[model samples]
Target: MDDPDSNAAQLASPSYRLPALDQDFLLGDSMRGVRFQLEFAKAEEVLRAWGIRTTLVVFGSARVREDGPGRHADWYAEARRFGKLASLRGGAMRDVGQVRDNVIATGGGPGIMEAANRGAADVGAPSIGFNITLPHEQEPNGWSTPGLTFRFHYFAMRKMHLAMRANGLVVFPGGFGTFDELFELLTLRQTDKAPPIPVVLVDETYWRTVIDFDAMVSHGLVSPSDLSLFRFADTAESAWQSLIDCCLKPHPPSDYVPVP
Candidate 1:
């Protein structure tokens, strides 16, 4: 005969567990807000714990390859060199009495993002990558500091994280995604939603050839002052100089404490 005690042991208790623990419930439409919060908080917690007070966000294409494409390879080289320069001089290497500032941050994918992260690595400074999950399968580049790599399912959350602690923006030649990130920051700066920070657009010929900002002013679409929001840099040193000239240098994190 079957053991009656075994039958009782086999019974499951659906009410014993919290509904929030259920993956199906968590993935449903009712839990979308919760998912967003999770995405934001997880990275926020990690970054905070890592002592990242501020960031210099680098926006660029993921398609560029070193020694494989046209002018893109040159762009990659410049981005990497600029990354190293920024990390070395932007207070990236934390000291006993000072907090790290303006650490290299990227979209956390291949191409220029990889170069920037690799550049930071060259100086052994920490870097960040805000990677977004795509339907087509994109992953974080290998160069970003391991613990600082974050994957975000929500683009809005990812964008928020990118802009929140940003002290400056370094944009390189790219396609639609790059344009979106650049314009998003520009729009924020124009509206005073984001404070004035140096926005350096690398490769003057590429930018001018792609979009005619001067024409936008000529057409009276945007005010003349809007044109002043961004400047062009042809090399790594010039990019660093532009940040200084624009008074966009980063400050220590608000919560930083001085060591005795």
Candidate 2:
């Protein structure tokens, strides 16, 4: 026979807690796989609900600022302009469709990321910010749609989400972090691990100075054909055109016309 006090104690014990409610157990080392799945599923479910079918990912330096020194302002402005242009023409403005293509996606932090997100906000289009947990604690830019902003602890998981839905890639001048992401996608493209997608490097002069593709070819570090994987553009208009030339499909204007 169970005494009332003993029954109460048993019910309150940690061991008796439901698995889902046991934070200690759920966060333990053994549950890492479960945590990974949870991370993936949480974002996937929300994206599906929001009908984000394809994304135009923008990668750039977080150090750039609108009013900062030198070409930083130019880079920021172009990124913002590209974001708005892409949203306006890339089917992201369609209210009647169940799918949104070419929606602007960013790192969800400041600098170029904030500029792109702000561009989407300019025309009242929803954007995505895939933020990562960093030691310095990067915050999501205010321009990304509140419901679509997400933070992940694992860089691998964050990158997977970024790459999995990308329809095109627009890269701006950046340093180590940006190079990491740029090369990863380039490698995937070279190996055919990812489907062919348009890749545009904004500011041909900046990119040419930063990466010596010709030198790579001369050194046999990369094949001549590998250089064809991406193109260079000097402005937002040219960047969009480069994507179009490389077969980044945009929905017909009629499909995005608002229903009265």
Q: Which stretches in model 2 have alpha-carbon errors above 4 Å?
A: 1-5, 252-260
Clashes of each: 0, 0
Writing each residue's lDDT as its tens digit, candidate 2 over 1-260 gives: 77766678778899999999999999999999999999999999998888899999999999999998999999999999988888988978767446889999999999999999999898888999999999998999899999999999999999999999999999999999999999999999999999999899999999999789999999999999999999999888899999999999986346454221
Give me the candidate number with maximum lDDT.
2
Candidate 1: residue pairs that collide = none
- Estimate every model's Cα lDDT from 0 to 1: 0.87, 0.91
Estimate TM-scores for all models.
0.90, 0.94
Model 1 worst lDDT run, 10 consecutive residues: 251-260
The positional error of residue 51 in candidate 2, measured at the CA in angstroms, is 1.1
lDDT, model 2, position 229: 96
